[model samples]
Target: MSDIRPKYKGSLLRPMKALSFLFREPATLPMEPREASEVYRGFHLNDWEKCIGCGTCGEICDNFAIRMVEIPDLPSDPAKGVKARRPAIDYGRCCWCALCVDICPTGSLSMSREYIHVSRDLDSYLILPDEAGMHGENFLKGWAKSETSDLLDLARQAMGELEPEARSDNFDEVTKGFDAQSALLEASRCIQCGMCHEACPAHMHAPEYIRAIWDGDMERAVEEIYRTNPFPQVCGRICTHRCESACSIGRRGDPVAIRWLKRFAMDQVEPQKVQEIALKNKVSKPTGKKVAVIGAGPAGLTAAFDLAKLGHSVCVYEARPEPGGMMRYGIPEYRLPYDRLDADI
Candidate 1:
């Protein structure tokens, strides 16, 4: 017989691979209420004690699936990183990306394997996640932050500063702020969540402005800052940054130096450039709407700035010789120098 004929000696038993499917469970299970996979991002579990209610999750969520809800009993403290508010996940909108978990400052968020929920009540879909599961059944964690996939840049960019030897000798500004490459790298750490805005007393548009800064549109960012705040110089320097405290990144990593970034952007553009940009938004024709805004503080100045931009005849009367009311008097020159304040005016 030919040697080729012997090579075709097929096994009489045939391959057993096809038989395995009959014994195995299907990957896509029936929708008739079953447990999720070990790593299925089914639902959220939040530790109330660990969550600061900064709402960074809501801000970074591309789907707008999360909201910060007020829980009356929850204590609110900025320094300790606590908020009376807590994140409420809307299952209707959650994409199960687990970005919130990765960005949570306190690492209080996680996903659970137990996933089935059946109810006619739409309200049930909206849950203020706590340590307990959706049905109060604390299940094993599903989608959690993995070392490789965690999005938070825990370490802050080392801000360039005057050397201790050099700094001690003078009253010069200590921080040199970020350069072009540094600012871009640092800004990338931000998740564009408005948690910083919510935490701020002035409610500055941090996300929008930071985005502008990231895009290298310092002029646009300066304009955005001027939208809600007239004292960018003051805020960039001396304001108590509730924004940094509530920063979602701060939960696990160094919060973005939002104040410094703002200062950097303001510093990048010349005063005349800022004035030109500001004038673009100014109503030049004059509406003749006379609005008398009281005080020259951030609130008052912000109001006056808006009114002035809106074509209204606005005059801000201040008791102090300076334009900035409390900021000029209360804040130290070391923190916010008079020159920067003058630039803002």
Candidate 2:
């Protein structure tokens, strides 16, 4: 076979053409940093003041690059659901997905436009960012949370309740408790952030119970509820739920139905079963100690309950016909049914 391709004819001038560019100006731009895109996913920037230390960012990070570090000097208020911790980012493992910023309930986490960080020290790659950039220099905000970018289910499930006209005729409980389906749907909304647990006065294990409820284990949910609270039925009905206020979801949307979820769990279990669960941890041996509680109100009864559980003999005195203090004598029956209060007592 004959080759049709032509052979190349080399030129002496072509070899010298390469040297012509050396005399001309260089084509490449200067090696200096330039502005990045407005919404570029770059280094992290956290507003420590706005961050509640929910650790949602750490939980959502697929690479496990975010870690919550305790800052001893930072203020912590359990009632407000604030923690003395901050997130530290490991750039080596980060993918710059911006998911941490989108899921942040407080909108305190965002990416900065300045992304360059060149260092020989390995520890410099990991940083606890504040408003300043990676090098402690101010940078423009990059990707951040917006209504369209939020990943949380802000709107909670609608609660079932009796119509005003229907409730006007009788003193029956106006708010109908959640059904199994609605309860599960509502429980799924929780991120298990533990914010509610800190905000609760009893320090109730809300995240544990909510997860149990979502898993469809009514008995386990009930058990978790009774761990810190003895009066589930009463508290579920009328106690002020500070936990809801501290709910991370409530920052952008309606908070989870924590109070109603408690009521639902209590309603699902039998009264006898609830009583058994509540007393499951009571001391088997009597301590032979006798204690007298002045009143049979919530506080006094709680004291008595604790005392009795510790194998101590406790006696409660009540001036009124019933032992519920303001919960019984003050709150209307329509709001809190007497039968429910009795079950709690």
- All candidates' lDDT scores? 0.80, 0.91
lDDT of 1 by residue, 1-345 (tens): 556644555685667657878888879856676667878887899988777777777877899999888889878765444668989899988988989887776778899987777799999999988777898888888887778767678777777877889967666766677888887777777877566777788778988888998898998889888777777876787777888887767766789889888887888898898887666778769997798877887678878878888899998888777778777787666567789888777
Best by TM-score: 2
**Distance from true position, residue 17, model 2, in Å?**
33
Scored by lDDT, the top model is 2
**Clash pairs of candidate 1?**
105-251, 105-252
Native-structure RMSD, model 2: 7.5
**lDDT tens per residue, model 2, 109-201:** 999998888789999999999998798888999999988998888888887789989988899988888899999989988989999998998
Q: How much does candidate 1 score in TM-score?
A: 0.70
lDDT of 1 at 241: 85
